[model samples]
Target: MNPKWLTRAGLCALLAIISLAASAAPAGPPRVAVTDLAYEERVSEYFRVVSASSKSSLRASGRESERDSDDAYSRRSSGSLNARSESNYSSTEGTYSYIDRGEMRKFTADIKGGLIKSGRFELVQGKPFTDTKHTEKLYDIIARIKQGMYPGADYVLFGSINSIEFRQEANPIDHTNTVSHTLSLELVGEFSLINTRNYAIKSSFSAMGTGQDVKLLTSQGGRVVLNRGKVVSEVSRSLGEDVARQVEEQLTGVSSAEERDNSYRPRGESVREEVIIFK
Candidate 1:
């Protein structure tokens, strides 16, 4: 055979294989836009809750009674005692929030991170939804979709916080003179994935996360420090992951967490609860 003719034949065969492989490749993963979780701007509650086991609240009531904890100029009850001398004890309550409007995205960000980490979908930046608490501006999910809040996204993962709570408890540890302080935070949220084109919901689920910080205190009315930011971050991250996993399972019919090997935990990962001991 002529060398030039043989070389031409070999080139033709290589091109044919390349063309076939290209055609056989699967489509790229679906693109997703995870919106910031929506919530009602909480009515700031000005009130004091005290209990025999809640020394932290007692101290908070005492400090807040003597000083203005919020400089944001919220509506406070007059009986709430417009900040008096340190020696005065005022039994007043006001309405305010423990969280700010700007920080609510931590929950949404967690779920987005989890979905991205799973590599099951491509996540995109999403625009903010209207403040749900303010009725002056009606919430129109369809209009928001039409405005391209999540441009170039095939689906939208919408989430809303249903309930959130924080509490503290203190008790004497057994066989010791020390007191145990435990601070607990819990958050619950509802989620749904909707097809942007037809406005159909593909999947819906709810996820909850809880975190606790425990420390030992001296019996001398010692206080337990509360890190609202730290615990919120921890809970949001775990909550996001849980929501992401649930979304994946629901949409793809994968195995549930209970059906899998739940006992296996990777090394170096932080646990949701931590214990601190003080003698």
Candidate 2:
């Protein structure tokens, strides 16, 4: 046993541990350019009609010729006539309009924040996509990256709404019944890994979420009035989690490597319209 040799060995071991620690420490979360999540305004062909019956007065006009009654027997029968009547139909239509884009923007930001906090990846905060009105393009991400928003991003994530629909059906018996309106949102996500040196897509993957029912409401008047923002928020949250999980699986090789040739696979079944209420 040589005490001097043991001390030297301990010093070397300490230096080696420090080096490993430095190498393992993350520089930061992965820089991601999430395109503005675009949404589509989808209209449903299904419609419901409600009818109500109420008592109301009606006016009628009549014309008579006095000469036609010349041979009348002078017998007049006094009776009342009942008639089925209808009034001018009046209707009002209502629907859920797109909520503030800020909600969705904040949602994605929070998702990124959560992923970073989980210590999964270093998240680089870049400008939020403000163009919520147009089809997403890869150039947008490249343009922002070139502009120094994301100086050194390792990947880019983008998504779009394939369709969003809400439908309601009224009960035949109850004319004034409440109809269930189910909100289904389909989101498609695409990921591209960057080389950082050449900024090329080293690897890419795509996933989709279909028939995801985010919210439900009762039809009011002739329209369904629900909080679209809230629905989008919930859907976005789920979409983010699902996409992150898929990406993680791809990175860790947990699931089958996404088919590069396919590039895209149907994520889930089309969401079926749900009946929240019969009336």
Candidate with top TM-score is 1
> Global CA lDDT of candidate 1, please?
0.73
C-alpha displacement of 43 in model 2, angstroms? 16
TM-score of 2: 0.45
- Predicted candidate 2 versus true structure: per-residue lDDT over 249-276, tens digit per residue: 6665555445421332223434457778
- Ten-residue stretch with the least lDDT total in model 2: 260-269
* Clash counts for the predictions, in order: 9, 7
Q: RMSD per prediction, one decimal?
A: 23.7, 22.4
Candidate 2 collision pairs: 28-122, 29-121, 29-122, 29-123, 30-122, 178-279, 211-271
Worst 10 residues of 1 by lDDT: 53-62
- Global lDDT of each model? 0.73, 0.53
